[model samples]
Target: MTASRLPQFSGKTGRPELMVILGSTLTVIAILGIVTFLLIREHAGAKETATRSATTIAQLIDADVLRTVELYDMTLQGLIAAAQRDDLRQVSPQIRHLVLFDRSTTARFKGDILLLDKHGEVLADSSLIEPRPGNFADRDYFQAHVTNTGSGMYISRPFKPRCDCEDSNEWRISFSRRIASSTGEFLGVAVASMRLTYFDQLFNSLYIGSDSTLNIIDDAGILLAQKPYLEHDSIGKSFATRPNVVRILREGSGSFESVSSIDGRQRLYTFSRVGNLPLTVIVALSGNDVFAAWRRTALVISGATGVLCIGLLWLSWLLCRELRLRHQAEQELAQLAATDSLTGVANRRILDLTLRHEWFRAQRSGQPLSVLMIDADHFKAFNDRHGHQGGDEALRTIAKVIAANVRRPADLVARYGGEEFSVILAETDSTGARQIAEKIRMAVQQLPKTEGDELPMTVSIGISTWTTQTDVTLEQLLFAADKALYQAKEQGRNRVVAGS
Candidate 1:
């Protein structure tokens, strides 16, 4: 047997086939490396463009808001001066008469002017609204002026008020300031309420692009004003459920890619927080629009890469084809391992990697952390009613909704299971977590349900807040939220319930 050993197929040291194989492998790697570099450059350029656009828009809007605030301040000061001298009575009618007597005057003042007392009671008003002389005492603006001495000038939250002229409907945004006497004693609050329709018009005129939107949220994350005005409960509703907005408010500024709330288009958003104000300005640009140039560049680079690859293959056709196939197969395997085929989100393996990374980050920063366990209410029923296809569609829709609402870059939205989703709300407290849960409820309700469904689609959300003192494991936090989700279902569906 030893004498009959077959000859091995080992090639000579300088064999042409071995040289061709090595040369082709190196060429392919170099081509791939060049393509990757170009892609990275394109991505960076797109990001820079987006950031610049967002910053410019934010600054312009900030200027307008500040100007409005200043105007309100000046108007209040003028009113206060007149009220203090008891000259408002003498100035208006007297001035009108004088002007009329001067013969050259064709203009007349078109707006009503009112003077409010310390408690927001209208002491004197030119327009003569009924129940007026003492009507506004209970108004929020008036109350704010009376109580907060430091509040020099205040803009009231939007509200709808009954019209004195029975046929008219007027909803207004009020601006107010405390009137102080010579010795600094509070005299009264001077208020002016402008119809919100006009404000809406002004905001609408400041468009960035086709689908761009502007919203003004108050300190409580309440939507005080928007370009295309929405109705009653919709106006003051909190967006706490929107994790992205929540993140901006908490962290001051951030950017992310997500689905738009208004148009349902994919977009890259950049948010800037207004200085010394409970306001955040968000500028969103469509992903395609923002990265159009980069995409074009990518296409060009890809074409070049293809050409280069073909040239290399042609040069080494006799030897290197098998090696290229093997390399491609490895890449495919790696991509598959990292991706979740069902939801198209990161798979459980990736999630574990993320959790460990975020855990260490929180530990180093000493910040509060929270988690939300979200379960679709009656999801099994949905599966039964619509079949697996329908269920899959519903899951995708819910995922999109959740993704749209997350406010922070660090926040994670994941499909935890068949009918469950989870969110990691960083640096959040219990109160904040509860508010976020409610927002999720509202957003789900707002989704259009399919025809013939007895109950509209809804979710049961469980939230748990974490702190350094808690000594609780991440698993424990998940368990708490899960328990809370069950409680929410037990209490009836479509609601948020928080765990201790």
Candidate 2:
């Protein structure tokens, strides 16, 4: 015989929402951390690129200026040699003027040559019909050359030309060197002037960014030139008091972030000193431009992560739903497995299980356990007369009456097979079992026959009781009840008989 199976489960509630929320929270935190790291890495990479570009641009400008100044210095050296070697004072004025001012007047860069005396008095001029009367003692280039008498070139800050100019009146910077005698006595200053357009035009070909800037400042924090070109410029402004200038002065070359003193926008500043010329080139890129690409990437990543989290939550919901349905299905299957398909009572499987368990319980408690085996009498003859469908109806009606008779919670009524049914009554002795069987017999006898040709309805019940003194096995109890049922059928039916 099969044993009873009743599925059980814990009645506590599940926390799928909390679990899903916890998982999504961790995922969001991880994504944020990755996004943060990527932003920082991109910022650093962009800063490095700006630094290299600025340093390269500054060196290139320094080289170009150096070459341009050297070219004009050669012209001055020629003039100085002419005065020393060729006795340039003995040459005709017209030939000397043509020789000195030809390139200066024709060149696009506006390179002007000037000769200044020891006291910084103008001796000659290239872009002039005649030497203009001007005192140059206060000029930085002139003073530097006269005092040092150096072989190298001296560059001055960008300023307006200190002369009457009929040509383009653009600002210019001076490059000067000392002219000395064979005895090393400083005689005059040889100077070459270059317009500010030279540096500004160089930047015109570059495409840094909309919010980008380029500045050329001296070691003393004096503004030399900048682009895009400024009108009514701050060319002469000295940055000696500015905080950024102090930083630029400390480091020869590096990159940093700071707010612009000019416009107050925070920017990435890449700076470098210009070729030992005491001129620093600073490239400032707005913070927005530098982080624009990274921001876009972060946006895409965030959107994708949000979608993924939604998908994960949906998956979690689906799983919880599936688990609930599975539990319901499992409970239904267990009930079906233990119940009779035809009459909806506990089947033989459950009856046998309850009988065995109650047998042991009765033995332990010194209480009585009773079993009643019931059968519809002459059921085969009834089916033959009224048809099998009528037989099924009679069996259902009798099973219902039997169930009604066994009323206690510890009592179980089961369909054994065909027209046979059984009842398990725990803590019930022979007298109580006989009373229940008699009641079942009287109830089944009263069922109104549904078919015209049906035989009279009736039941035969065989009762078995177990107590502490009865050393009977569960199988022996069932066998004894079955024997009593056979004997009742043999004798008259519709009666109750107790088994030994």
Candidate number of the best TM-score: 2
Model 1 clashing residue pairs (backbone): 117-188, 118-188, 243-405, 243-406, 243-407, 244-406, 244-407, 244-408, 245-407
TM-score of each candidate?
Answer: 0.53, 0.56
Q: Lowest summed lDDT over 10 consecutive residues: which window, candidate 2?
A: 1-10
Clash pairs for candidate 2: none
In model 2, where do residues sit more than 4 Å from their true spots? Answer: 1-24, 46-56, 98-108, 163-169, 229-232, 310-500
How close to the true structure is residue 368 of candidate 1, measured as C-alpha lDDT? 78
Per-residue C-alpha lDDT of model 1 across residues 1-500, encoded as one tens digit per residue: 01011112223335455678778889899989978987998798888888788778777777766665566556666666655654444666656333222211211211334566665666655455232545677778778777777646676676776566652454566667777766778887767666655546656767666655566676667676665433445666777667666766786777778886545677777777666665677777668778778888899988888898888878787455664575556546654665556655445565556556666677888787777888898889889989999989888777767766776666666667788887777788788878877887788888897776966789989988778888888778778888998998899978888888
lDDT of each: 0.68, 0.76
- How well is each residue in 252-307 modelled by candidate 2, as lDDT tens digits? 78888999877787888878776667678777777778777767876887788678
- Model 1 residue 309 lDDT score: 89
